[model samples]
Target: MSHTFDASVLREYDIRGIIGQTLGPDDARAIGRSFATLLREAGGETVAIGYDGRMSSPMLEHALCEGLTSGGCNVVRIGLGPTPMLYYAEASSEEIDGGIQITGSHNPPNYNGFKMVFQGRPFFGADIQKLGKIAEEGVWSSGSGEVTERDVMGAYVERLLEGLSGVDVGELADLKVGWDAGNGAAGPALERLAEKLPGEHHLLFTQVDGHFPNHHPDPTVEANLADLRALVAEKKLDFGVAFDGDGDRIGAIDGEGRVIWGDQLLMIYAEDVLKNHAGATIIADVKASRALFDHVAALGGEPLMWKTGHSLIKSKMKETGSPLAGEMSGHVFFADEYYGFDDALYAGVRLIAATARLGQSVTELREAMPAMLNTPEMRFQVDESRKFAAIAEVSERLKTSPGPDVEDVNATDGVRVTTKDGWWLLRASNTQDVLVARAESETKGGLERLMAQIDEQLSLSGLERGESVGH
Candidate 1:
C-alpha cells in the first residue's frame, strides 16, 4: 500500500498536524512503513517506538507498529513517556536501530506528530522528506517482523537521579522546589523523580492529560508559567521548573518570580560543565542573549551562536564537539555527562546541582547575570512563500544601506544585525508562516533604538513591525 501525506504534516522539524484532519492512523501506518523501509535498507531492523499522552497517540502508535512490522522491521514498544526517554532507549540500547516518538510536542490537544531518531542522531529536514519519497514510491520491505514491549521508565529515572551525584547531599535538605508538568506526558516520570529527589518538592498537574486543562504545555510563553510562579511564591520555594508537553523543553522561574530563560539556564549549566571541561564549546540559538555568550567566554569556554531548533542545535553540538547547548525556547542539551538530546527532566536536576555546586541560589544566579532589555520573540504572519524573500530583502538593504555602520549582520539562519545599542534579529520561522524578530540592548533608550531599526527595516520590506501575536 502507498500513502501520500498532507504537505503541511511534514514540517521542517517533524511530522505534525491537526489530528483527524491532516493526520490519522492511516498516515501513521504509512510513516511506519516508510521509516521501517528506510531502516531496513540501512541494514537495521529494530525501531524503538514511544508515545505521549495525547488522545490520538495510542491509535497512531498501533498503526505505526503495524507498518513497521509489515515493512520487515522489528519494533520495540516503550509505551507512554516523554520524548527524551525514547531517545534514551535508542542511545543506551545497542540493539535499537531507530526511534519514533509520537508526540505533538507543545502543540495543542487537537494536534499530533512524530519525532524520529535514526540510530543515535536526530532524523529531520532532508530525512523527513525522504520518508515522503519512500511512501510515494510504494516500494517497502516485504516481511513480517516482531514487536515487543519494554519498560524503561525505572532505568531512565535512575539515570536522571545519577545527575545528583555532584551535588552536596547536605544541601538537598535545605532546598525546596516546585515543579509544574502542565499535565503533559512528563507527569508519571516526574512523580517518580520527585519521590527520589533530595529536596522538598511540590508538584502541580502531574497527571498526564492531553487536554492540558491548567494551561498550555508550552513553557516558553511567559503566561503559561503563571501557575508555576504562583506555586513558588505560595510555597516560598527556592525556584520552580516546568516542562513542555513532551518533556523536552523547560520553563523556570526564580524564587523572586522572575523567569530564567533558556540562555540564562545555559549560563548556569556552562559554569558547571566548564569547571570540568574547560575550553569546551557551548552553543545557543541566535535568539539567545549576548550576555550568555559572554558568560561562556568568561568561564573559559567557546561560545557558538547557531540557528534555533532542537534538532539543528543537536546536530551543531555534535559537529563542534560541544559538550553543551540550548535554545531560547527551553531546549537544553547536555553531552557533558549524558546523551546530547534535550531532556527537561534532566535539566531540572542539573539546575539543582548547578546551584548547590556553585554555592549560589537560583535567585542569586538569576540576579548575578548581566542585565539586558529584550523584546520577547515576536512572531507575525507572513505569506509562506514571501517570508524568506522578506528576510532576504531586509538583509540586502542592511548590507548596502548608507546609514551608520549598519553594524554587523550575520545571515546564519535568518539575519541578526548587531549595532551599538545592541542586536536585532529577523528570521523566518522554520515551522510556521511567520517572521520571528527580537532585539536586545543594555538601556531602555538603546532598546528603543533597536526596535526602531527593526521597524524601519520591516517598513522597507513592506511589512509591519508586528501585529498582535499570541499563541
Candidate 2:
C-alpha cells in the first residue's frame, strides 16, 4: 500500500506534527514501514521501539509496530520512557539493530513526533526525508516479524546513574537540589531516579500528564522556568535542573534562582571532562558564548564551534572523535564513558558529579564564570527562499568591507564575526523559516555596538533588524 506524509511533518531531526492535523496513526505506519525498509537494505532485521507519556504516543506506537513487523523486522517494544531510553535500548543490546521513540518533545499537547536511531548513530537529515520517499514508492518488504515487550526503565535509570561516577556517593545525600519535570515524559523516569539518588531532592510535576497542567515542558524559554525557580527558592535548595518534554535537552538554575544556560553548563562540564582527557577537542555550537570557547582553550583543550543542530553536532562529534559537545539549547553529548547522544538526565547527573569533584557549589560555579552581555536568540521570520541568500549576501559584504573593529569573520554555519567588543552571529534556522541573530560583548556599551553592527548588516541584506524579531 502506498502512503504519503505532510511535507511539514518531516523535519531536519525528526518527524513531528500537530496530532490529528499534521499527523496520525497512518503516518506512524508509514514511518515504521519506511524505517524497516531502510534497515533491511542495510541487512538488519531487528528493531527496538519506545514512546513517551504523550496521550497519543501509545496509539502511534501500536500502528508503527504493525508496519515494522509487516516489513520483515522483529520489533522489541521498550515501553514508555524518554527519547534517550530508546537510544539506550538500541545501543545497549546486541540483538537490536535500530530504534524509534514516539515523543512530541517540547511542543504543545496537541503535538507529537518520532526520533529515530539506526544501528548506534543518529538517523536524521536526508535520512528523514528518505522516509518520505520510501512511503511514496510502496516498496516495503513483506514478512510476519515477531514483536516482544521489554521493561527498560530500570536499566535506563542505572545507566544515567553511571554519570555520577568520579565523585563521592556519600556527598549526594548532603546535596539539596530541586527538580521540575513539568509533567512531561521525564516525569516517571525522574520519579524513579530521585528515589535512588542520594540527596534532599524535591521534585515538581513528576506526574506523567500530557496535559502539562503545571507548566510547559520547554525549559529554555525563561518564562517556563518560573515554577522551577519558585521551587528552588522556597526550599532553599542548592540548585535546580529541568528537562524538556522528551528529556533530551536540559535547563538549570543556581541556588539563587539564576538560570545556567546551556553554554555555561558546558563550561562546567568541560572543566571536569578536561581533567580526565586533557588537550581534547571540545565542541560547541556557533551560538554558544565566547567565554565558553575561551574557557575550553584555557583548560588546555582545543575548542571547535560548529553549526546549531543536535544532529549536526553529533555527526561532527563522530567525524572529529570529540569526547564532549553541546549546543546553546542544552543538548549535551558526552562520548567519554557513555553513548554519544544528548541525554539531559545524564547531564543532570554529571552536573552533580562535577560539583562534587570540583568542591564548589553550583552557585559558586556560576559566580566564577566570566560575565558578558548578550541577546537571547533573536529569530525573525524570513521567506524560506530568501533566508539563505540573505546570509550569503551578509557574509560577502563582511568579506570586502570588514566593518569597524571587525577582527575576523567565520562563515562556518552562517556568518560569525569577531571584534574587540566581542562577537555576533547571523544564521538561517534549519527547522523554521527564520533567521537567528545573537551578539555578545563585555560591557553594556560594547553590546550596543555589536547589536548596531548586526542591525547594519541586516539592513544591507534588505532586511530590517527591529522589534519584530521573535525568539
TM-score of each: 0.98, 0.98
Model 1 spans with C-alpha error above 4 angstroms = 468-471
lDDT scores for all predictions?
Answer: 0.93, 0.91
Clashes of each: 0, 0
Estimate, for each residue in 1-471, the C-alpha lDDT of model 1 and write its tens digit.
678999888987899999989999999999999999899888899999999999999999999999999999999999999999999999999999999999999988999999999978899999999999999888887789999999999999999998888677777898999999999999999999999999799999999998899999999999999999999999999999999999999999999999999999999999999999989999999999999999999999999999998899999999999999999999999998899999999999999999889999999999999889999999898889999999999888877882684678989889998888999999998888889989999999999898888888888888896584543
